[model samples]
Target: MLVAFSLAPSGAPTDSVHDAVAAAVRVVRESGLPNHTDSMFTTIEGDWDEVFAVVKAAADAVGAFGSRVSLVLKADIRPGYSGELTAKLDRLEAAMEQSDDPA
Candidate 1:
């Protein structure tokens, strides 16, 4: 399973949430799970229980920054498939490359 999530804190002292976001991301990085972080979301690949645990821990870490935390999550649950993180992007790139070639 691949879970992509974003976490934010509300009622924070400052308008910038970077510090809170960094806290959440640190939890993800230390989990030893296959993960990727971009400008918007952090995606983790692992079994359901393990993955959600990390997500929960990350959200909890964000809670310290403000009165409340909000999380947005999306999941791709494919039982037999693994490594879709890079593989999906690889396939998309291959398709785009093929489209550019003249027959």
Candidate 2:
């Protein structure tokens, strides 16, 4: 499973959310699961329980900073699929490279 999620503290005490975002990312990174974080979301690859545990912990971490937390998530759950995280992107890149169109 690949779980892509974004967690943040809404109405936080500070204007900059860097601290809270960092806290949430830290939880995901420290989980030692295969993961990637971009400007929009952090994608984690793991079993259902492991992935949910990290997401829960990350949300809880951010929730500490404000009265409300915002969590947005999208998941691709393939019971027997593994490594689709990298493989999916790799396939896309391969297809792109094979394209005849040029700008």
Top candidate on lDDT is 1
Off by over 4 Å in 1: none
What ranges in model 2 sit over 4 Å off? 101-103
Expressed as tens digits, the lDDT of each residue in 9-38 for candidate 2 is 987878777888899999999999999999
Candidate 2 CA-lDDT value:
0.93
Candidate 1, residues 15-88: lDDT per residue as tens digits?
Answer: 89999999999999999999999999999999999999999999999999999999999999999888999999
Superposed by TM-score, candidate 1 places the C-alpha of residue 44 at a distance from the truth, in angstroms, of: 0.7
Q: Estimate each model's TM-score.
A: 0.97, 0.92
